[model samples]
Target: MSLRLTLHRPPPGRISLAGIVPNRLAALAMADIERLPLAWGKETPALGEFFRVAGAPGPHLVFEGMDARFCDVARGMAAGECEIHGAAGDFVAADLLGGRVVVRGSVGAFAASGMRGGELHVQGDAGERLGAALPWQAAGMRGGRVIVDGSVGARCGDKMRRGEILVAGDAGDFCAARMVAGTLAVAGRVGAHAGYGMRRGTLLLLLPGAAPALVPTFVETAFAADVFLRLLRRHWLATLDAGGAFARRAGAAEWRARRWLGDLASDGRGEVIHIV
Candidate 1:
């Protein structure tokens, strides 16, 4: 059975649940796990102080009744699966290397920052800087796939180096700002200044009728690369849920896009494709 940790009471302060991934928990005895120290604000406390731990140790870890005070859930995880039954705090799945993490509710800021590989699926919204670089880091989200079922806040994919982020709902302002390389597909509206200062990447905006206002640095291109669009459509079809917003939009027609290439202010290479 999967290891389960159910919060019995709210933490007094922010709790960092770093290094509590499935791979590490699977080897620890119940007693040892209960004794594991958690960084709770200015103090450290045994995990058992706030959570009731149960179930057999295994490759899957399940968290129940978590709230915004729980940070770094599954940070740096390289293997196995971690599931959160409720909302999570900042940096959820940050620096993930390999594995699958599913958050059933909203996540706070910087979710999936510095992630290298793996899949992070959020059934609800994500806060600011989703997949963006951390404060001390230069690049963000080197690899991995993040699927958000709801909207994301500002600066999503900022300074990203590589990876794929699929958003079913709207994205806030400055989405994909300073992006270096990657694919960011947003199904709903994106706020102003989208793709500002982008160097190299693909920003696929799936808004059907609305032509989002972009920075003047981006100039429309006439490249009707039908083959590439077809391939991209195929990829999204396989990656997203068959009945999700992204899949429905992507599968609606033969892939045709009004492409723009620029942020000439930066490297002038990134492309923003608006579906017609």
Candidate 2:
């Protein structure tokens, strides 16, 4: 059902494991990639020197090694189920199109930069710019689901255009800057500029209790009585939809959701849903 792989040696320069996810390996056998593309590493002597491969029999390959030192372990990867037993380095799930990467430990900076589609779940803390766009380019996370079970550094979702990013713990400053679309949910209190300059996108906040800071430019639109929240909770949050999005209360006040339009700034139509 599962296979185990231990990496020890690597190759020279930046070796990319761009196509070694479970879904990517579905068609080919492990032996088929013994020497080629399957498990490429960087700045070492050779592939055999770094990995002590034992179980490569099935479709799933479970690697038990210090992967925190390996960058781009799953870069530009499409579909698959990658479960990292240990923490991962920067660019953990960079450019993933489809599939799921679950890190039992922490993650480095730019965790899912430019991810088109897929899901990345980090059980621990995360580094800077968790879901940010590349330097020089624009747009981050066109489509995907990124959930951090713990805390995160600054600029969690910088320039994110689409997708859903949820941080169960506190998020550093600049939670979702220049966001064009999508949703960013932070379970704990946030730092300054939580949604500063956000063109469009929904920000679901639970902490900093009372009422959120009125940016003046945003219009308060009621969402308490909206039926769409029920759909989102049952589908997106599932058991975690404790907010009013799934609440049983309904009234004019309940339907009131402050709608802030701007960061005009951009040609976007994003929504910010804050229910307290």
Candidate 3:
């Protein structure tokens, strides 16, 4: 039987679902978490009051028709797949080290920030400063995959050390600000300040547009014998219904990872791709 948590409505105020599900990286004390303190208007309450909890602690978990009022549905998840059926608030999959987080719709701000590993695919659009470092933090998401089916606000993928982010739509300003390493693929047009202070990494453009300003050293190369592109397409396959259909038609296999090097301002080793 598939262990699923049907989230209908969330309790008032901020409720943390961090470590709510056990991951391969660590073990959870269900008894302790169940009895752990939760804030409810200055009062502590058990997690049982809000939504019904079903399923034992394991590597796999699923949420059915999760509400918009809910935030941190799968915060700090380490491994396995967590599917959110609808829209979500902030930090949808913050600090997720591994596994796949498939959101059927859009997401809030700071989505996938500080992520270490795994994939976060948003079927729709996204908010501001996506995949970027949080306040006072040195770097944003270290590694992982963040795919946005639509546009994003400013400062996306800021200070990202490694991983891959593909946006099939448009973007806001300061995109990929100060990227340390990784690949950010924009399918459509993008805002200003692309790769502003990027020290290293690749920024790919699938659409027809001019390169961002404030870039110094640069080189555009043709698609060479790069195997990583094939690897990326295969990684995005859907496992089940609804999403599975989308995956089959995602056109992910259309583009091969061609290599290009640029952002000479930082002697950046990053490569930007162009889809033919």
Candidate 4:
């Protein structure tokens, strides 16, 4: 059975649970798990002080009763599975290397900053910087897939080097700004300044009225996306119910698209596309 951590009471302050992923805790005894130190504001407290733990340590972990005060829910996880049954705070999957993380509720900002590899599925809305770079780093999520079933806040894939980020709902401003490489598909409306400084990547807009203010540096193009659409259908869209349906309709052989290439301000290789 998997270990479970249920909140005993509302935490006094935001708690940083960054290093408590299943891969690290699965081999520890219950006593050791409880004794692990967690940061609560400026003070440190044993994990058991805020949570009631049960079940044997294992590769699967479940967290229940999480709220906005619980931050860094799965930071630096290398492997295993983690499921959060309720809302979570900032940096939900920062620097993740491998594994699957599922959040049943909304998340705070910087949800997947600097992620290297993994699968993060958020069933609810996500805050700003969904897959953005860290303050000290130049690139964001290097590899991975982030699927958000609900809307997302600003700068969703800023400075990304590689990966795929799918937002089934609306995305805020600058959705793929300064991206070096990656694929970002948004199924709903996109806010202003989307792809403002993107250098190299594919930003797919699947719905009407989702156009961002095109950067003047970009040159409109007529490139066909036949191969790109097929790849998405075969690898990504086929896995989700709504996404699959949307992909089928949008990926039809007859479907035409409008493309724009740029950040001529930079390498001028990135593309922004809208399904027509």
Q: Point out where model 2 deviates above 4 Å.
A: 8-17, 23-44, 214-216, 222-225, 237-269
Instruction: Please provide, for model 1 over 49-93, each residue's C-alpha lDDT reduced to its tens digit, 9 standing for 90 to 100.
Output: 988999988999999999989999999999999999999999999
Q: Kindly provide the TM-score of model 4 when superposed on the true structure, using C-alpha atoms.
A: 0.93
**Candidate 3: tens digits of C-alpha lDDT, residues 173-202:** 878878888878777777876777777877
237: Cα error in model 4, Å: 3.3
Index of the highest-lDDT prediction? 1
Residue-wise C-alpha lDDT for candidate 4, range 97-142, written one tens digit per residue: 9999999999999998999899899989999999899778899988
Model 3 collision count: 2
Candidate order (lDDT): 1, 4, 3, 2
What TM-score does candidate 1 reach? 0.97
For candidate 3, list the clashing residue pairs, or say none: 133-140, 201-270
Candidate 3: residue 99 Cα off by (Å): 1.9
Per-model lDDT: 0.92, 0.67, 0.70, 0.86
> Which residue pairs overlap in candidate 4's backbone?
none
Model 1 misplacement above 4 A: none
Expressed as tens digits, the lDDT of each residue in 184-270 for candidate 2 is 877676777667678878777645346566344455554442566556655654433344221222211333343454444444355
Query: Which of 3 and 4 is the better model by lDDT?
Result: 4
Alpha-carbon TM-score of each model against the true structure = 0.97, 0.79, 0.76, 0.93
